[model samples]
Structure formats: structure tokens, C-alpha cells
Target chain A: MVPISYYLILAAVLFSIGVLSFLLKRNVVTVFMSIELMLNAVNLTFVAFAHRWQAVSPQAVSGQIFVFFVMVVAAAEAAVGLAIIISIFRTRQTLNIDQINLMKN
Target chain B: MQLALFIIFAALAVAGALNFLLQRHPINSALSLVVVMLSLAVLYWSLGAEFLAAAQVIVYSGAVMVLFVFVVMLLNAGEEERTTGSRAAYFAGIPGAAAVFCLLSFVFLSESKTLGSSNLGGYLNDGTVNIVEISKILFTRLLLPFEVTSILILVAILGAVVLARKEPDPKVVTSSTDAAGVIVIKEKV
Candidate 1:
């Protein structure tokens, strides 16, 4: 059996990658994709803990429930976020975050 | 067998992430993100969170990703030249990612031997947990965060609708210049 640490480590790595992508990417869509990556990383950690302590106790279900909430939030976020992106694209003809500066020095 | 599964998932996740990051097209990036979500769903199932695995697929891959794809289609956003941020940003991001990996590796190496040392009693069979039970805890114990999430989603929905809703202005496009123009606009509509 693979150890729980392996899964945790994988989660952490993915999360970091997501953060890097989010930070560096200027396109709004790519930034959104990075957010998806971060969410997936959290899901990975939840499942890892869920499996690590699968004793049919509260701890077992906690991770799953958290993942459930994460899904719900992701759904709502995508709905609204994508709509906003579309509107922005319609007006500006671009999704470049850097060029969309409303307030800058 | 578990190792093989882990390797497969890890590869899929990495490939998907790269696809998402490297693609210039928003539609392609959204598609890649879907692939990533599916791979994570599989990983969730492997970790015995069957309900979570299903939710990951249905909610994220099915619903959320589809929304992303739909919006991309509606907006008709074309590919743009990639933004290579400042050299300082490049330097900072790479080291930041590397440092995170190093930290995670340190934790993994330190805890690897200790993981299977302690048995977690027994594995959950039948592979299902009571949603009602979990909901009770969530509502009672996690009420604040739960309400906050709801509010966030609500705000997001309203914001999207307000932003996307357009009052069509006749002046945005001028009167048809030629019979050809009318035909083309008709076709587009």
C-alpha cells in the first residue's frame, strides 16, 4: 500500500504549481484554470486523509464532506466567473489581465 | 497495483496542468482543466472517497467545466500572444514552486516510514457515508463557513448576470451597407 505521505506530498506539489500558474498567467482563462488546479489539489489532500483514516468514524467522513463543499463552491464559482469573463471579452476583445487595469500607477 | 495507480494519476494530473498552463486558447485550456478534474476524481475514488469522487466528476467535470467551455464559446475569445511577465516574476515563480516541492518532499520523506506503522483500525467497506450525518455536522458545526460559501456563490451568480446582461443598442452596428451585408448579418444572427 502506498503511504499517506505520498498523497499529501502530491497534493502540496500540485497546489504549488497552481499557485505559480495563477500568479504568472495574465490571461483570465488561464488564471481560472490555475484556480481549478488549486481546487483539485485540495481535493487530493481530502481524499488522502479520508483513506488514511478509513475507520468509519467522523474523521473518515470529514474529508469527504469537505470535498463535497469544495465541489459546490467550484460549481458556483465557475458559473459566475465564466459569465464575467465572457462580458469582459465582449467589451474589451481581450482577456489579458494586465491590460484590464482600471487602477494603476 | 496502488503504486501503478498513483503513477498514472500523477502523470495525468501533471500533463493536464501543463496543458492548462501552456495553451494559448481559452477553450483548449478549459478542456485541459476538465481532464485534470477527471483525473482527480479517479484519484478520489482510489482513496476510498467514493461519494467525493462522484461529486468531483458530476459537479466539477460535468457542470463547472461545461460552464467554462460554454462561456468561452459565447465570448469567442481568440488566442493572444502569451504574457511573459517580468524577469523578476519568472525568477520568483520558479524558485517559489521549487521551494514548495522541496518542503513537501521533506515532509514526505520524514513521514513515509511512519505512515503504515500505525494501522487506522479498519477500512470502510460498503464505501458509503451518510450525507445526512455529514450535513448535520456541517450545518451545526460549520454553519459560519457554510453560510459564507452560499453568500459567495450567490454574489458570483448575481455578478455574472449583471455583467453579461446586455441591452442591445441599434447604434452598435450601422444600417446595412449592401445586400451582402444584410445577408451576412442574417446568417450570423
Candidate 2:
């Protein structure tokens, strides 16, 4: 049997990397991808805990179910986020985050 | 055996995530993200979340990332210019992150003996937790949140369409007379 800690450690490592990218990357899309990475890391942790809790109760599958909703919400967020990114790119004529400073122009 | 499988996939996932972060072009980052998602799906399967594994692949890798790639192409998102932030941040940033990673891993290792020490082959012992069971629980207990999610997606679609579309010409608005009885001259293009 594989230890649950191994999965958790992996998630933690992945999440730290996600944070690093989120802070370091300049392109809005790259930063956005890092957010996805962070979400994936969280999903891994949830599944690990879900696996551990499977022995206790009837609601053994709750973690998995939550992961389902997280994915749905991520999809919606990506749609709106990318649309905003594209809109910014159109008006500002640049995808660089430093340039898109105006609130309404 | 389970340890081996987990190690391999986890390594792949981390490598993919690194590639996504390091790549300059948005397209390359998007592709690496796909790799990360696929490996995570495999990890979910190993954890016996069969339905979640499938959903992770289908929705995240298939749909969400495809949208990312689409927008990357549509916007012509180019390589990120290296920001010349303070020299102190560039020097301290990575080491700071490494410190955080070390701290977190230290905590995880300390807890490993208590939390991680579970027997393998749990799925073989416990009857399969399949799609039907997940759906049964979801439809009954989680019904409201599911409905709310549907509405959220609908709003996202509307918002995306509205935000991305070009606005009507300002000259067209000028053609109509104002209520204050002011003469609004229609400029000839």
C-alpha cells in the first residue's frame, strides 16, 4: 500500500511551484496557468484525504464529489478569465500585464 | 508496486508543471499544463476516484485547457518579457520559495508516519466506488450546488460573449439627438 503522505508531499511541492510561478511570471496567461496548477495541487490533496476517509462512513465518496465541482468551477473561471484577458489585449494592444493599467479608456 | 506507480506519475506531473512555468510562450505553457492534468488524472485513478479521474481528464484537460490554447492563439499572447524588478527580489525570490518548500516538506515528512501509513490495495478490498454510486450521492445530497454550478456556467458564457465582442461605433451614438435639445452633429466618415 502506498502511504498517503507521499501523495500529500507531492501536492505540497506542486503547490509551492505553482505559487512561485504565479509570483514570478509576467504574462497574465502564464500567471493564470499557475493558478490552475495551484488548483490541481489542492485537488490532489482532497483525493488523498478522501482515500483516507473511505473506511469511516457512508459518505466515503465526498472528496471525489467535491473534486467534480471544483473542476466545473474551474472551467467557468477559465472562460471568464480568458475572455477578460482577450478583451484587455484588444484594447491595450499588448498582453503584457505592466501595460494594461487603465481602468476605463 | 503502488509506491512505484505513484512515484512515476508524480514525477511526471511535477516535471510537466515546471515546464509549464518555465516556458516563455503561452502555447508551450498550455501544452505542459495538459501533461500535468493527464498525470493528475492518473493519480486520481490510483486513489480510486474513478469518476473524478475521468472528469479531470475530460473537463480540465479536454475543455478548460483547450479554451486556454484557443485564447492564447486568438490573442496572439507572446513570450513574457523578463520584468526588471529590484535586484533584491530576483535574488531573494527563489531562495524564499525554496525556504517555504523546505518548511512544508519538513512538516509533511513529520506527519507521514501518522497520516500516510495506510495499507495499499484498499480498492481491491472495498467494492468498487463507481460512477453510479457517485451519481446517486451527487443527485441526492449535492443537488443544489450542482444546479448552482450550471447557472454559474451560463453566466460565464454570457459574460465572455459580452466582453469579447466589439462595441458599437461611437459615431453611431452621436447620430441620435440628445434629450437636452442640443444639436448633435453627425461627423461624416
TM-score of each: 0.80, 0.89
The reply for model 1, stretches above 4 Å from the true place, is A55-59, B117-122, B126-152, B167-189
> Residue by residue across B105-144, what tens digits does model 2's lDDT show?
8887898877754444334354655576688888998899
Report the lDDT of model 1 for residue B99.
90
Task: Pick the lDDT winner.
Answer: 2
Q: How do the residues A77-105 of candidate 1 rate in per-residue lDDT, one tens digit apiece?
A: 77777777777777777788877765665
Q: B6-114, model 1: which lDDT tens digit per residue?
A: 7798788878887777777888888888888888877777776666777888888887778778776776767856666457768888798889888878977797876
Our tally of clashes for model 1 stands at 0
Q: What is the lDDT of residue B145 in candidate 1?
A: 84
| Runs with alpha carbons beyond 4 Å of true place in candidate 2 | A103-105, B85-96, B118-128, B172-187
Each prediction's DockQ against the real complex: 0.50, 0.67
lDDT of 1 at B152: 84
Query: Which is the leading candidate under DockQ?
Result: 2
Ten contiguous residues minimizing lDDT sum, candidate 1 chain A: A51-60
Candidate 2 at B73: error in angstroms?
1.2
